[model samples]
Target chain A: MTTTPTPSRPPVPGPPQDTSPTFVGMPTFHRAARAALDDTQQRRNLHHATRTIRDKRSRAVAELPHWEELRRAGAAAKDEALDHLADYLIRLEERLTAGGATVHWARDAAEANRIVLDIVRAKEAEEVVKVKSMVTQEIELNEALEAAGVNAWETDLAELIVQLGHDRPSHILVPAIHRNRREIRDIFQREMAAVGRPAPKDLTDEPSRLAEAARLHLREKFLRARVGVSGANFAIADTGSLVVVESEGNGRMCLTLPETLISVVGIEKVLPSWDDLGALLQLLPRSSTGERMNPYTTIWSGVHEGDGPQEVHVVLLDNGRTHVLGDRLGRQALRCIRCSACLNVCPVYERTGGHAYGSVYPGPIGAVLNPQLRGTESDIDRSLPWASSLCGACYDACPVGIDIPELLVELRSRVAGDRGRTAESVAMAATTWLFSDPRRLTAAQRATGVAGRLVGDRTIRSVPGLGAWTNARDLPNPPPESFRTWWARERGGGTREGSGR
Target chain B: MLEPRDDVVPSEPRTSGQRVALFATCFNDTLWPETPKATVHLLERLGVSVDFPADQTCCGQMLTNSGYGSSALPLVRRFVDVFGGYDAVVAPSGSCVGSVRVQHRRIAEESDDDSLADRVAELGPRVYELSEFLVDVLGVEDVGASFPHRVTYHPTCHSLRMLRVDDRPLRLLRAVRGIDLVELPEAQECCGFGGTFALKNADISISMGSDKARHVVGTGAEVLVAGDNSCLAHIGGILGRWRTGIRPMHLAEILAATEGTPA
Candidate 1:
């Protein structure tokens, strides 16, 4: 017998809105993840790469006996900075000005972008070389600069690969992490020429070769660019110094060589004291790239009169951070040090790749961070919270004690309860009502157990309504008798053993 | 760097005035009765009394994790009402206990129910997942069971990370006589049986689950065991669909098996 077909999805609670520019008009996470899951090469690349990195991180972290103390200190430093964020910001600005640096405050992405664009326009530079920055990507500074006829060149190797390939970053640290070496070779061969210097004609998939090709291609842009833009990993409030950490020396080049330099920093990157930096330094490199220390750590307070960039500008960006700070449950996300350890460890991030998150920040941290940074009004932001299995692997890997699973669940509550009742929420409400009382649960179980008995012992290969589950996996037929029923009949339910076997 | 808290793990069963209750959990009650039954047998063998509170339905995990935090408040209250008197609450699930400990508190505080929040705090540590109950609280690594077969244990994500019951199940399995326990490759990775995640992100979940299945198959173990039946059901479904000829047994099921009793 045939039955009526029901629509697979109930109505979405809110209108679908994609807030991030790089992935504008992107679908919800599951839809995008479904597509990413189909890409066999990407899956293999992510699986191998993440496993290698995860193993390396474990070894690196094992070396530090006092790693927990440093981690706690780092988290405490961030919390302390965030607690008195206003005071720190004022002190930071004061120190920066005293050290002969200019500073700008941006309340939002538009303001941040505007501030950067105005700086580039003032310098009259056609192109500005950039240190790899999640904040810059968050504000879509390249797009903003490009729109105003100013080119923003990503100087970091991974960011450069993403820029040259015209692909959105998939991971926070390794932006083109979804692309294997072969794909990177292809990207360099095909896309690098149009941007700057052409890739070598005899380019292979060798790592060293790819580095050489990128270095050679960016050589001209580095020399030609007069202005540099960057984002700091840590902005020390005490000395007003901005620190940029990198494996490659490209961040250093962007920090010093340009005649005019500007740094776009998140207000949350503040470290309360110089003493706090070493503890965080120990945690970050070990957690981030599994290195004892990053190859290059650039700390510049201000202009040093012919030593570095003649002029320096620091833009302190809010950009919805205050909104996140207001949320007691979610404020811990601000403690993130931009370490991709969570991304590397996440199984969901491993399977789906970063594009599935549809934002600059992806992985477990992104799942919690994106919603708070960009409100849950958008479909992608709303769906981000559900992107995980609530696996605490991210939290386990987090060096800064950002309880990512807790944050994800908290954000999920905001997504569910803060909105108008959807079909899913109504269904959850029904289950909640049934489970609130044991009798209701027992009565329902009894009815289901009776139905299950009638269905017999056959495994359920497929269910018409739940094709998502049954299409791939087979569920066991429910046992004929519920545990409660079995206990009541044979073991005398509710009879206490009371210290007697 | 959460410090290794393995010291908190008890190595033998406690024999005293402590009262124990089994939270069969909604899923195990209706679908997998054998697991809870095996749990009872295993506990009885250790001279520990186990009580099943008839009023215990669920720990409100499904509702809370599904984003219905407020809706979970009633069920949270229901949980306290039922299990509040027991000295220790045990379940055959790590995820459920993680919820009762983690999400229940989040729900109470998020909804601003001060009394419920305090009750959840008091109740959190008393709740133990199976492996934790057996190795950490009961403090017994061996439950006097003999399973003569090749077995591989998949440490459920919640058990491995959330509950941090590292090596407890393995220690229990290691103590079992006539058992060849091979290490599962990439065992720390999730099996991808994330409730609605299996439904919503079906493709990714399948990808992750199938990979886990591949690792489990590579072990050449006759039985794939874990603490949570929910994860087993998902992994076992893939194993079943693929006709891998492997059985998915709960940890308690294998531990409860004695001479001439093959689980």
Candidate 2:
């Protein structure tokens, strides 16, 4: 192997420590994946949850005769929106402002949290009730709120389970997918009292009972909350409307009950018009949670007089999104509707769970999205691209038809570029050189055959740099003679035989 | 019963005078020679002339997938050069064909080689996986082959999803006179031999392979069949280590078998 000499350069210090307390000290994907593999309960929980969701999604998608057409339309709409994102955002801002909603633009997560906090403090509210929003989690908004002396109460049942347990969410649609009924019951029994009304003293390991306990507890917070925070599924530019689809009614309660509503939406969530909502609404529910339609799809065009929250504020969050959108090859990640269907069907996510991804957005979409959204400066973000096996399941499941594997390859090339010359690069270079000429490849194959003779006809168990391949399986014994050599000897030197008889 | 989808091309026997070149892929060329031999035998039996192009090398799937697209460019150019003149190029592996058809254009575009991209676009459609060539190109389902033993077919992910060569393999297997083809439970899931993925992420790869092996063994079939040798090698390796009585065979081998010479 010809090693490319490393260019002489001054040694640089490592990437700065992630000072954000919520995701601080998170391990890289390789380490966290190893740890997660040993957790059999988490594995079981993930396997069960993903399998159930995948089967349901397949069934749900099968019911639509025009599903493929709908998927194409959804993908086309997102592409059009992404092509004109700046225009749509401006129009959406104008429409929302005209409809009696105040809009705030944030360049990053810190600015977004600061805007939301200012709004809360101005109202003199000590607490805020929240609808489960991935953008909020992505920005670690709850941690910021808590640090600023405001308690944020999660109203989504699964989100409540995760909050009460002080555990990170492991799935997109089902935040508590890592927990079973028994684990959820235990979390509720141990941690509910500190937050609000205690769980029922007779709380059992039944799912319905656990849900009821959560419902009763969140009801108290809902009635008294003066401020509500949310994330939107889609923001319509034509009407300045925001839509949130949820199985539970928490989003409705959060949108309607509070005196003031603050929505923190990613800038990429805007659609060109209300006409785009039909395909997406059909795609999202079937792809996520595998329902014909979600129970509550609340659409609000700013504030309705005395009907919903009288005061509404939409925080248009950039938060590294513009950087992602700037990438011509990678901007399709912006087309994600956050359905979590990609996660449900990804084998890597099934095995390692979401925490291994080290980002709020996990699974196949995260593998591409997180690396670009948060530059690959950190180890976790760098490792995220390699998290997938490049299976096309995510692309198949994605309602918007994001070519996730292609994006993954693109991101991998970027990550590979930063490393300059390394062992993998040298090896790949050598392999490429060998294959460039058939003669060189023949010689290499002959050498490999000679090496195979040293080990005989038995399966070898291990090799350097291939511990991963041999850890659970054995490598095949190489054939004594390569087909090229055999063909040369037996088939008159690789020339075509006679034509069809 | 799991019936074949209507989209699957019907196996109507036709004598095609088309000349074909075999891009036997580096894997079958180096390690799994039986796959290429079987493919040659099967194609020849169906009355289509087959040529083994001597200068053909790897299709650069391994290089491209390992984040070495720049390194894979020459191989792509070389592939088009070697097989560009043929009426059709056939390979035993779906993944290599998938790389050639789907990823080669991107690699060319990445380097801004318009000629290379145009060449790939011209040659991409002519490359075919084994079952696709038989069921779609040659329009033959029962290649007058018979394997008396029961077998289960694992649809490799690339063939199932990337190439969308759905049910073609199953249809071919079903038409074999004496073969009792059983459905592999959750057969559409990947066997985790994602080329370098098996090496870079060994633990996950092994876990996935073991699950696949268990399902294959559960079917009580004496042999497990698949189109791609890469997947067969990974799952076959696990089965070998576990001492399972089942053996992994390429689809070409199963399709080439006849009552007179059982594979």
Candidate 3:
């Protein structure tokens, strides 16, 4: 079995795609997801990668008997923090400021970008090395930084592939899960510098060689960078500390090696205290990387004394998170620990892959979280809630117990409430009208049975208001006799003993 | 309206007096008629006198899940009217039962029927899935039912996730007489027959169903039992296609098992 080295994956050559970050006016999920789904290579790459992660996660999770309890605590803690978020933010700001770290609050993506760009410019740094940050990906921060004339180099291996390849992250943990070894080999051969070593002179798809190539390429940038930017795994409000957990130690280098450290974090990533932080630390690594402990767990509190970074700045980003928190049923989505367990176990995510989600977050959690955070007005966002088969695997896999399927249905209802012409809602209303009274249901069944014979083949090739439904499957033409009709016929077509209620 | 203290059973058990109405779901009323009978049998065996209100019809779960709150209102009203007086209402099908217990209030509140909403909220917790009633209300894990089949249980999504009745079915299954319950891998995952979702998105639905089918086959059991027939039908169809040795049955069918009778 080809255990393709994770970091050795070839770099995607171009800069990131120029499509705007907002999923506004994009095609429906059926269209967008299908476009991605049609690519057999992407599907295979995703299937193999997700399956590997899921297997490792199950084993890692199984090792802890109290995983469920730990998850519950983590979820509860996050919920509590969200409920009193303003207070925690005040506390965190006070603590961080006291510790000599300047905290900036950004209400949305534009503000956050402005803050980071201003900080990088003020530092007068020509370039900055970044640890892979999903929030930055969410806001398209690298592009923003580049547009502002500051070059940001991605330090995470998978992130480096995505940035260099000019591709969107396909999976949360392994952003480059959509590209295989041979594809990586091709990309590196095409993209890497010919003046310096020229990609190992026909580099085979061997994992080690690829990893060595990435290590060599990234090592130069890491040592040369004067400023570093990153996203935090968690922020402890009580200690005014930030944590970054990763399988690779590269994040540690980005956090500590640079003279100035700038971390962009979502406001919802806060925990009230260290005990709360401890609960999540146990829950996150196992659920995310399927590891007992992440290879590197870095925690930095403000400006350390002659250690790590002398100048530290933490930008707490809101960006619709406050709005998400205001929704009672929808608010639970903020509790996500970014374990990607939900994505790994999700069948829809398994098939369509993460890029189709049109956001940094994907899978069941993304289906609910993205639409709420971004507002479900756009076609892609509206289509997301319907992306799932409502299988609830993500809920099962979620260490925080997000109840994702319920939220998906809830969001779908909100979307339908917006459109006001879903046909599903109409059919359901008609069915309910019939079911409320048995007489009507039976009459309707008989009427449909008559219609069923008129169709003859008992298969409808087409129907109005439901084009997608007929794409691959057919309705059973109301079944020759309804179960009610069969019951009556079996009882000699006579009014059975309790037939007329 | 009524005395709040008199309506709900307190945390402490009051075994001397309790009442319940059996809203035999449409599927259980006609297609799987024995499910209601089994539910009644199990409840009576546990010293609870259950009333099968013949006027009860479908709970409009099909309508509500399909997003028809307006049409489902009358069904909710009828349900609240028919089974209103009983201390508790129980049903064999989790999805149907879950609809009544969970969605009924949502539908009523959306329709602006405040009184109906109040009634639904009161009746909600009282409406339990059969295993939930057996375990929580009747306070007995062992219902004294005998099923000798080598069976594996598929915990339907509505029953497990929506209702949060995780251990009820498993607890009862473990206590059954002469039953060998093989643990199903990924038992919490959905079987993919999400009401009309199976018909609407059959390709993706079948993909999910097939995955569930494979997991069922992996259990090496002779039978698969679940609370919802909608899910069972989907899994059964896939099993039929594969010509797998296992068949899908309902928990009620398993619990209704008699001596020397094959389940």
Candidate 4:
């Protein structure tokens, strides 16, 4: 097994300490989103990449005559599986145990992290190689592993890019979508010594060259790592098994070569049975990568004679999932197959990109899920619900029929009602008082009309509460006459239908 | 203005229940009270009892949408009190009806008033927008209304997707003897009124509004009708600025119009 040399460099500062302040220190979804908006290069990369995937997905989806049926069945299966989750978990646990797979239940992120750490320690492994896993990212697993005195190497190419660049993932599939090949080449030049093989002496900014650079770096980890960690796309309860679907074979190598395999999977990842897995296997790849089938779909049940990892541990994580499940309206979020069709189709997500969401999950699903998982108390999560245009594109694109726009609106209301803590409450109260009475409403409109006249062409340009709005747009001027005046004039004169217009 | 026409003066086919209360929304009450007046005149013509609830007010949707839920709770409770047990509580706006039905329960629960929450939930499903109540609940699509004009329907977001009252308004329009109900292309997308959303994200809002206006003009309908005037007003404002051949009118005003009646 080739051993990648650890690059020596000044250590980067740790994760930001302020978790309680919500959006206090974080930039708004708008500003954060704006960073990538004007980068024509990044926009070209994203637009080209996303459109290709979208076209491919449409073709793949159209090939299946039962695609819609499969989607419905997938949704129904998820619903039924969630309905009987406790029973399914027990069944899953028993079968897995009988098959020589140990199952650990984690209530939240911390517990799951500790469990994975313990497994790595017990295996006496100094380093663990990882396949691409969002759950691991969500738990900040690499940071935990590093803190516990171990190196967690990312094997997936995109994951490698993010890890090597010391950056947060901006897009779910691409992770480093914000970076072009040249920037990637720069990162490789700087960080490649971390792996034993340095970047090619004359590496070009070509895609193949960058990919080869990463492959050369990761090939060593795939062969040498004693422990491997992964996140499952689906865990089948009927037969004790875990499945990782991916475009690249890196996931396969990570799953099979390691002595001890540890998987940190969200509890919501479980499917009811094998037939359910069959349907999902068909849906996931097409919706996710727009491929007819994922190139590498590695499914492992338990210990086998002379093949695969002998020591298998599955860590089932709750991590605010039960609370999400408890909500009748919100629980449907758990049904996500993570196809990311919604994200690809979302106009807001398209323009703003993913980092603005300030969570592992982004796009319409992120807007609803993040707030629900963390609760709306934080300003970041609160602002997420308002991120969408309520355009319903996400809903249209969703395979499982998660009503993202409705959920966003629901979350927005919850945020607004945060015990009346915001300035909007005061404004609403005052406005309501003026509006409930007819006479007051007319007076206020006339008053606004007059005030609108003063701001007429100069565009007021700066207002405190509304500056967030006018920053990019203009406020319309109220007409000289309210509709009431128009009506009154039409009535006073001869009542011709053509008289008003 | 026509001598303050206080006396009924025998309008055609007037209904006789004076107890019906008007829940004129902030949009209608402030921006366009003519909608409420049209509602009252229309309901009065159908011989239905109509009363302008002196305490009737905003459904608190604006505050609730803005993420200020606690302040909006009182408005929910008060609206319930003012209009709850009446024969029916009708708002000219689908968004307001949606708030009363959809959001009030949420607000009531937040306030820890289970009973009030339960009541709001119970009364909420019954609260209907004017066209919905008239057609779906009241079973009266043809209000003896006659407006000889080409009209297209704009389905508000809350009304179309939220309430899922798809064909009731169109069915009513179809039944209207003289009104032409032209099909609107992409009728389900929001007009971007979104309560405070129009002012909050005016750029995207205007973009969405322009899209909607383009659709409205595409139909070549002389008039655009919608259940919620807030959406109509936003689209109307755009149409007014662009001087499109189309004018906006509420469904209630169209249903209320009789022969020779100015719509």
- Winner by lDDT: 2
Candidate number with the higher DockQ (2 or 3)? 2
TM-score of model 3's chain A: 0.90
Model 2: how far residue A125 lies from native, Å:
0.3
Provide DockQ values for all models, in the order shown: 0.52, 0.50, 0.17, 0.14
For each candidate, what TM-score against the reference? 0.93, 0.94, 0.81, 0.71
Candidate 3's DockQ: 0.17
lDDT of each: 0.85, 0.86, 0.75, 0.74
Residue pairs clashing, model 3: A8-A210, A8-A211, A12-A164, A12-A165, A13-A165
Instruction: Tell me how far the alpha carbon of residue B227 in candidate 1 is from the true structure, in angstroms, after superposition.
Output: 0.4
Ranking by TM-score: 2, 1, 3, 4
Q: Return the interface RMSD of the candidates, in order shown, one decimal each.
A: 3.4, 3.3, 4.9, 7.4
- Please give the ranking of all candidate structures by lDDT, highest first, separated by commas: 2, 1, 3, 4
Clash pairs for candidate 2? A468-B202
The per-residue C-alpha lDDT of model 2 at residue A159 equals: 94
lDDT of 2 by residue, A86-165 (tens): 77788999999999999999877888999999999999999999999999998899999999999999999999989999
**lDDT score, residue A271, model 1?**
86
State the displacement of the C-alpha of residue A2, model 4, in Å, after optimal TM-score superposition: 53
Candidate 2 lDDT, tens digit per residue, B141-186?
7677778888999999888889999999998899887788998998
Q: What is the TM-score of chain B alone in each candidate?
A: 0.93, 0.94, 0.90, 0.89
lDDT per residue as tens, model 1, B157-177: 888887889999999998777
